[model samples]
Target: MKRHDALIRVAEYDRFRRPTSIRIDVTAGCPIPVVRTIFGAPDKPTETVVNVSLVTESHPTLDPTRKYKDRCRLARRIADRLGIDEGCHVRVDAGPYATYYRVYEIREHDAPLVVHEEHLDRLGIDGEQTVRLSTTIPQETPEQVRERGGLAETLVDDQTCEGVLVTAPHGGAVERGTDAIASRTYDRLDDGGVRASLWLLQGYNPPEGSAVTAHRRWHVGGFDRAVDGYPGLATLTGRAFDLVVGVHRSGYEWIEVGGRIDASVRERVADELRTRAGREVRTDLDRLHLPGTNPRISTNFLSKGGDRGLHVECTPGTCDRHVEEAAAALAETIRRVLA
Candidate 1:
């Protein structure tokens, strides 16, 4: 469809719905390509302020009503590329996946222009705190909370061919849909003529055989061994995979591809994904290296054997809506890179 045909109308656009802001990549190529591959010439990531608490540097002086409308217009264009109905509620999904993400909540204090989640955790402003600042964090008793770390369970599908490892520490109940995303990715990697190990934290009840019996949160708790001394997540680093891939869920429509991938194959991978996922492809810039997967972070995926792993964050919507297509594309991209 033409650009003029894709205008967003909001009968009631709720911003505080999540309080978290997101960015959508609007380049070219819909249902078959929305930034993933459709309808434009622009190759830059567009900002969409979701949770209304957003405070940005650019357009800082703009009135609230005008800003909302402008964001809605940008969001509408993005959704249209994905075949989303006009006037429907939508949010940007790829921005949070960018290799670099501009964190706004830290603005409340004297913080850097851009920050990683790990940095916030170090400041004692953890994932829970971020949720409280943006979206809601459900309250549960310590007895019920998993991070206490008594159990341990990790699954490994090691083929030992390419020395690549695909991991999802937050899989299953830990992070909701992450396990499924990683599962598809694991199989995809295998199908691409390359072999690798896939590790998952499926915290068991009795710590069967070697799996951990505790149900602690992976990201936060995993850091103790890497940074502090927590034993729950200490073992993953020992695997020593050359290229570790830690996948997570995002809040935008496109897959936020990050990491300093070899310049030779970056565009090829992006193009493959654009055509497969039917969403726009965007590289990280505003947030170039997030602590979650950056090698600088002790517990990150990139710190593995080759220190070459990349952190891929996909929006909840895109992950669900384009899982099959995305898996095939991702596998193909890896195959191309290996070739």
Candidate 2:
């Protein structure tokens, strides 16, 4: 499916993970094709056709109060629209069961931002599902973004393609201490004589107390590498690697590790996290929410054919206070697995 990037937001959820917000933005002008049939005979199904013209709005141009030029401009604006089919609906791939709904309307403000209703009947969302969907990233990076808030940087070894890549897709104030953990992990791995590559994306200037709530704005999922036009992530994703490890912060208290890495490697990492980091470690797949097992996730996509990708979710306290210990746990895992 074609993905278009739009600003997506979700309000706080209740104990059952049901969204309580009034508005949620899904996409910008992404067309969803719905097919239907027109029956000419009462008892017979006649012809089927896709109505593409319904994607945009239209009205009579014969308004007496408006000038010809103004009317023409308005007509053109209405003619150019990203459309969704009338009967075809959109599915939110944010949770276990895909929720199909058609209660969305696109508002043509500065950019097309779609607003949709909350409460997907019965689907239980695991939070990450909201941000895990893919979207297109514009090829151009804006000037103000480059100068201040959003940043993407990379340090790669050009000599070989056998190195492992470590990335923190949501870094800086977006997730607080993730940048430090990712940076330190890369450094420790390099120090331990393991060839490694690093890509860090950081966000700054979140609303005074809304740092966690604003993460969706800065988080360009690992699946979408158009991250602020840095090109580093896209380039790294294209290369063959010995392993790919993604470090992230999670709400869980225990350090959670997931992905397609071997059983033995996972056990070693869990043991290290428990011994060196002195934290509870959880590697059981059945209990992980952000397991990074999806094939499109950065760790899975960048790992050498799904054999060596590790997704490690550190608690907020660990990221803030024990970043070094967590990084050591991962660095040791990488050294033993790839070195």
Candidate 3:
């Protein structure tokens, strides 16, 4: 058929009876080719690469309408290449004209018409990708890990390890602890060739000691563990703080203690930690209030916000030992919060 004549017929067919979505891929010889003709046309075809599957569909013609002129143009070119004839039937099948097409490829040259089909086959185009990570937590009460990100299923039979998955915001590794809600960092490799680490924490509170020292150790330990498991992991970070101390107004235990620290100091601390850990840390100090009764430290670490910090109530009139222990834990919580 004459190219121009073929093009005109294709255009008319498109206007009157175009299917919603048609999938195509260019022949490998023409990695980036233009649609020359539905059957044949003189107009320059729209340019597109043949690396991936292409879906062409008609746009709505209703009021405030969108016209798929480009798509139609491409479709016409494909139809011409396929040698679609007048009797060919095209119909919509799924989701209101989502997945439907009818057109047979007519051989042009006996040299075996070549077109890339792998792109469409690999897409699993019929449905969406299913989330593979597990959401359940087996080590602690599920309630403890609720609302934590990166809470996927455990890969190992033993309860100590949890499988973690990470995705970079912009195709690179994210700072530790910013991606998941675990107590320590766990390294994860994604299918897209990106590396990330998941930090998971098991305890609700930090162990007692020098608050700063204990938390630093915890952070280092978590990172070390992640590195050991995933040698490719460049860094590891994440935080896990007791909600009781972090989210005030939850009617949780916290003590209010008039202290020297100011909001600026807290913010500065938080900033420093973010810089050091390469991740965003969070804490809740406003909600740290005594649960049952007021204590010596009516509210310790009250009005707190730091690079990484958590505020929680301490029992009033508690013995020095208890206060020291609580203070240590609170301090570590701050470190993790900042981490």
Candidate 4:
């Protein structure tokens, strides 16, 4: 696509942020009546003393008459006018802060753009800020979805030992405590002089009373883990890793262990979980239909060609209570297996 640019006064356009209640990543919205009255076209200005509420800060869509897709349509229109491709990245420069975002669907619209609140916060725009929106077609576009930017991540590539990778694709509030367990395992491994690459995906949801759960908003399945934009998963799959351990959560009373690995090694890991972590371990995952056996799954995908990986699914209680023991057990077993 040809390069396009727009020197638009953001916040001047009918901008709205993603509210806690809104499930989708809505960046732009239609201009409200008050905005039209004061800023654009209206016989008499209606909004004299507008009250900006904290609740509204979370949700700035004054006129939420537009549906979820409609909001995206507005942003896409802005992108199109700027000559950006449908799936290409748009480099948005709001003063000092700059971010690259992949655009969603595109349709024609002349309405002013309403920036999403998250983008505003990231760009450090308070109110009525001017931003330079530019587009470029990079040689190698990152394999990421529209909501990829919404999810937070941490990637460690400098320290890689034994070609081992630790991952928590469903981290933060999505899978509750999976991120913590994965983090503990990574830290324990690092402290023990076995530095490994790590990738953690965390949700940015509020603490309590959220209308939508993190899993609903940002959960990327095992098969899609490596395909998604996170660098750690890609690194694991790209290299010849001897072992790849994925931490996850389940609702069952006992922890479940399943992955593409040697039968003896799987049994050993289960036994260690039972003895060291003092938690019940289930090895009959094939019967449960969650064997994690597919080579395309992140656990197996990250491991060496033969699917030499470990997938550990811990219960909520196990994650909270026995994470340290579980991490130690995993590290010890992994060190031995690698050796």
Candidate 5:
């Protein structure tokens, strides 16, 4: 959508449900051991404020808007999103204020600054041009997230025929950490036809400088080599591949399908999602690709595929608990479509 054509806003939400205040912040680089979001006030009744404790090893910036834009570059690359932010407004009737704490790690200044979210008030930019998902996402602590799964070695299929690529970018501990099942799902795909993979085994933000090639190509770092101006994924795209399936974990209450490919491909993947209900497909022109205020944002590989692709988002609650089983089932469905 054009900048002036239609603007996405918080007011679009039902009057009672809209977020009264919006925040956009960028935290210090990761290996960031602690991130505490203080929700309720000391009394736990009045909505006093929301706080973020980011432990980085560098100087925090005063320009939160620029910091926010830079911080989300990798996310836009990982998820290929083009919105102001993905926020969840916790309930609080009192003064809603925010604090961002950035304690740069003692030694690791190289770690990239990971930006979280930016909204109407945070940017001071026009809301119409931005797309924001106002979700009350549960801020799960690392321990809570680790409860689902652990990190695994980044692995890719031996076959480089470039037919189908199955990926789990946020498998280990990305934004919405999954059990690394996105990568684990590789073991289930029929190796004969698909080029399966389990990359981004580490937390999201495209593990930069961690690329290793003991056997198959292992670009554990963020999208690399840049294809068609987009980074994070280069080799995987640029081919007339059949399908590129990105199995991501959704933090929202429902499952969602993103990317703008052919209608059939989108619908087929949506049909394959193993959700009981609550599914949405976001194909708006700007939304289809991860378009942010910054130039770094671009179309994600799911829609950047040779002939369009499937960006499958899994809702853990509705999906089968047995991740391997659910993943394999979804893989099989994708293979069927390729056939």
Candidate 6:
């Protein structure tokens, strides 16, 4: 099937449903731990508020506009339901078709800028302070990592990849295939700290003879080598780009950028070819050959035995507009070769 047709099918399958909410029962006094367990940790330490509550929204089908509103309403309802004498802590996260809510309480002493001379004197600290650290890892597949313990904050980029921020209780660790990819630690004086860790997987290569792989090859280059060797690019591809695009498009939610090819670029190339051919063009990048690193466009129009199939491949990160230009260039190359 063509890439456009495949995308349309994915959209159809994601049809939205009516909104619904779920209120989880949480312990009152242990708000920090409970909140962390449910929604990871707060962006800041003093930000931890105890009177928090959590709610989830669901629907029968897609309702893009009302989804965020529904999530807000559910959060307010959870706050009202808690009905604590003190102010309630609330945070809401809503997506194209899903939403999550969290509420908690705040302790006065936890607030910063408040003088705690006695506490500081005992700890031998000079003044108010905070600590922050970040790190990431590599994985074979995103499914290899487990997400049961904490909520994940996802960052979406132009490509389909996502960067996820996960927080858990201090001293706890995130499990990734029997290995601890990240661990949360805290000191006696510290409120709590998040052990920032990341898991990256190499760019995806479709299994041989698989329909999905075949489809991807037709639209984009078959192998994604941009992220294969480099650690930074691999992390971005797996943790961010792969998650956003692959999850929504493939019906699988995980972060993995299998190759260096930019998806948007491939789509644009396919679109241009379809337009120029004045009919649907079948792309077959799988058989095309190029150097491991920098590749120059080349072609073989006639085989020793018979006419060889026309092939087109692209550089990593090529956008759709560029892909279109490249495809046109390839067509010209073919014309010259045949002549």
Winning model by TM-score: 2
Which pairs of residues collide in candidate 4? 14-114, 15-114, 17-117
Taking the tens digit of each residue's C-alpha lDDT, what string does model 5 give over 21-85? 32212234411122111121122122212222221222343234442222221132212111112
1-339, model 6: which lDDT tens digit per residue? 211111100001011111111112234442222111111222222211223222222332212243122111222322233222122212221111111111123233233112223222211234434311001112122232122111221111122223222111111111111111111111100122211222222222222112122112111111122222212232233332111111001122211112123334334434554454333332334422321112210011111111121222222222212333433533332233323
Instruction: Give residue 89's error in model 5 in angstroms.
Output: 30
Query: What is the C-alpha local distance difference test score of each model?
Result: 0.39, 0.52, 0.23, 0.53, 0.34, 0.22
Arrange candidates by lDDT, descending. Answer: 4, 2, 1, 5, 3, 6
User: Model 4, 1-339: lDDT tens per residue?
Assistant: 100011111122222210111011112442211111112322322221111111112234422332221111224445444533444434344443333344434446423244444433333346644555443211111122212323555555442344678888777666877877777777777667675766676653332233444454445552342232332343344466788888888878888788988877778888888998788888876654357777776778667884787888888887778778888788787777767
Better of 2 and 6 by lDDT: 2
lDDT per residue (tens digit) for residues 235-282 in model 3: 212221111122111112323321223455345434543443333333
Model 1 Cα lDDT, one tens digit per residue, 60-105: 3222333112222222332323222322222211211101111222
lDDT, residue 97, candidate 4: 39
Return the lDDT, model 5, position 4.
Answer: 11
Better of 3 and 4 by lDDT: 4
Residue runs of model 6 more than 4 Å from their true location after superposition: 1-46, 53-70, 73-99, 102-149, 152-247, 250-264, 268-339
Greater lDDT among 3 and 5 belongs to 5
What is the per-residue lDDT of model 2 for residues 1-339, given as tens digits with 9 covering 90 to 100?
A: 211122232234333222222122436464422212111221222111111211112334322232111111111222132123222222223222322223123334322212111232212332222212111122112233334433333333342455788888777655778878887887788677676767666654312222223254355443432321233454455576778888888888788888888878888989999998788988888888877788777777777886678888888889989889988988987787765
Q: Roughly what TM-score does model 3 have, to 2 decimal places?
A: 0.17
- Best-to-worst ranking by TM-score: 2, 4, 1, 5, 6, 3
Better of 2 and 4 by lDDT: 4
Best by lDDT: 4
